[model samples]
Target: MHHAFQIADREINVALSRARTGYRLHLGERIVPVDLRTGADGRAWLTLGDAHIEVVVATRGDDVFVHLDGEAHHLRYRHPLDRLAAAAAGHAEDQIRAPMPGSIVSVAVAPGDAVTQGQVLLVMESMKMETTITAPRDGVIATVNYQPGQTFDRDALLLSLEPMETCA
Candidate 1:
């Protein structure tokens, strides 16, 4: 599996690759071997080429914080579907749509409500199964399109979100 990670402003790919000894990284025309050791205390060590580096890693959701060789790095895990969805949504990550035909069971947010990423926005039932709708990012709600007991088709717009302004 190949995973894309955002470090600062750049996106880097690290793949689970096969090599004669173990896993390797594909960097352009170069294949680099990596040796990694992890500890339960969040401390880790990496040996790349002739250099050995000590690192400490902490994570919260998609955000990762790393202390490596006296420097700190923050990164985010970008999902594969995120870019495709953004392109299809015209770069607007505001619209919340239903995944399938369902009826609203409960609503956890309202118009103008502030929500954090992964926070439950509502619950719905389809085919006798319940699912929770969550906020994709931190934002203020713009509209709640349906109330409890309302039925909607697949891909129906459930809500909209407005980006919250940051304090300068």
Candidate 2:
């Protein structure tokens, strides 16, 4: 099965295949084999590589929440056609927000810096997984809301682009 999930204004594609030993996950060019089992307490055990980690997962509507290590991550399912249509329409989100409670690991841009679409702006870590946040369109950075090591809550505004000017 193939799935797409939206996080931090971008979509990620995942492909899942079952095997006799475990499940194979295709993420872009990387293939990871994992085993998952749920306990009666609702917590799940995930075996990745040689590591066994406990996780909590819940689903609501099109949103899936994953609690790994000590942090939570929310991933929203996106229709593939929706992404194509949005890109074709050239619609871009001006603001980027925290997908879940996490701390900034690094920052690559500051206010007033010019950035292009998909340019890396910052890196954040939640549940020991690092996520890179990127610009959604070509624009100047309008705000720098947090610094490296600063923690943020889910939906917290992390950055914004200067409003595009229009000429009549």
Candidate 3:
């Protein structure tokens, strides 16, 4: 599958395909061979050519957080259709929804709570992986519809925010 990701402030195009050995990663202008293994401690070991790197990964909603070699990186993946719809809407979104079916692990906000961009609103576990969902922009939470331990389907409305005027 092909995916577009926003990491830091840069947009990256990645094409992933299964290969006879493991998987092929088409990154930018180069095609690289990729191999993955899970260590006994649960960390992932990714091999690209002769280099071996150990990393921790976590996901929340549409964002991915990777801890690699003691450095932290945040990545956001956007479906092409989502991008197009957002563009057509004429403004960034004020609602946060589940990107996949998951059970709510925790809820960190309530109605009328003020939140900053990137502040975690909840944590959800899906497919045995925990993903933290965060505020997409600075705003006051207008509603929180789920409680801890609730299971929601993909695209289910989890919360809504009344965005700050500057962000609206």
- Per-candidate TM-scores read 0.46, 0.49, 0.49
Better TM-score candidate (1, 3): 3
How many collisions per candidate? 0, 0, 0
Highest TM-score scorer = 3
Once fitted onto the true fold, the runs of candidate 3 whose alpha carbons sit more than 4 angstroms away are 86-168
lDDT per residue for candidate 1 within 1-168, as digits (tens), equals: 446688888888566577665568776577778777786876688867567789777899999998887899899987644632442253276888876678999999988888887799999998798988778888888899999999997668889888788311
CA lDDT of every candidate: 0.77, 0.79, 0.79
List of clashing residue pairs for candidate 2: none
How far in Å is the alpha carbon of 53 misplaced in model 2? 0.9
Residue-level lDDT of model 3, residues 95-127, one tens digit each, is 777766779999999988888877989998877
Which of the two candidates, 1 or 3, achieves a greater lDDT against the reference? 3
Clashing residue pairs in candidate 1 (N, C-alpha, C atoms within 3 angstroms): none
Ranking by lDDT: 3, 2, 1
Write down the worst ten-residue block by lDDT for model 2. Answer: 81-90
Candidate 1 TM-score versus the reference: 0.46
